[model samples]
Target: MSWGVATLGAPTFLTIGLLLARDARSDHPFFWPSLLGIVALSNAVAILRVNQSHRRAAFARRSVLALCYLRAGMAAGCAMFVVLGWSTGALQEMVATLAEMLDASAPAIAIVMGTWSLALALALAFGLASFAHAGALHAWIAFRRGAPGPRPGA
Candidate 1:
């Protein structure tokens, strides 16, 4: 259930972050750093909460699950970013610039840029998706604790 939630939630959060970052790029120089800080704080809080609630082994498992979700989210988010860029001709413009710089063909430049963009997107998505997953899990944990029924994991 967590995996399913992360699979959908991570990409959605990442796409939103990308859009916000794109908008902030033109105006706010501090946006990226501020966003990164927020994500870091969120992850820290989530880790601490999980650590306090579970044994070491369980914490490790949860950590691994979160990492897996983060990677999946990053890949999905990057695909979305590429599609959006292509639709907006942003990718073409970037490719054109790089192609001129390296005297390469447009297709080659596109492939290279696409690869680079994936890497870049992965880095950006790491924090964004991590925060999303952590936030989601945190909320879930809170709900589970508040519910009247017995807790399976607890």
Candidate 2:
């Protein structure tokens, strides 16, 4: 996959999420959540692309697998928050209306902090993914160029 989509997309989505959630205000409520879903899907696709390739260096394969798992976890976490925010909008709105009678504001945890947390988590996941992919690419190049790689059992 392209670095822009795989590497740069992560930080872009994370930044969007952070900005949307920063002041607990959003110009469009679903904007950040939709982007989060896209980020999750994009990461997942990148991992799958790596997995489906047969050209990976033997030594690099193991490390890349670990990175895949890390990305999966982060993707799942981000998707969860997005799903929750989307599914619970009406419920939260109702609660907010009800809360108006009892309190002046809605709950503090209404997707704002969750989005920020998702963004941070995605940042780590994406960083690891980039590192893993670059490592694999470099190793592949080295192998193609006949550079010496580690010997078995050595």
The TM-score values for the models, in the order shown, are 0.36, 0.32
- How do the residues 70-90 of candidate 2 rate in per-residue lDDT, one tens digit apiece? 455455544554455456463
Q: lDDT of all the models against the reference?
A: 0.48, 0.48
Residue-level lDDT of model 1, residues 41-129, one tens digit each, is 44444445544444333433444545543444444444444554555556456555654555345587676776566546544655464
Q: What C-alpha lDDT does candidate 1 achieve relative to the native structure?
A: 0.48
Candidate 1, TM-score vs. the true structure? 0.36
- Runs in model 1 deviating more than 4 A are 1-60, 103-154
Model 2 ranges with Cα > 4 A deviation? 1-9, 55-154
**Residue 81 shift from truth in candidate 1, angstroms:** 0.7
Error of 2 at 28 (Å): 1.7
lDDT for position 25 in model 1: 62
Instruction: Output the number of the TM-score-best candidate.
Output: 1
Instruction: Compute the lDDT of residue 11 as modeled in candidate 1.
Output: 45
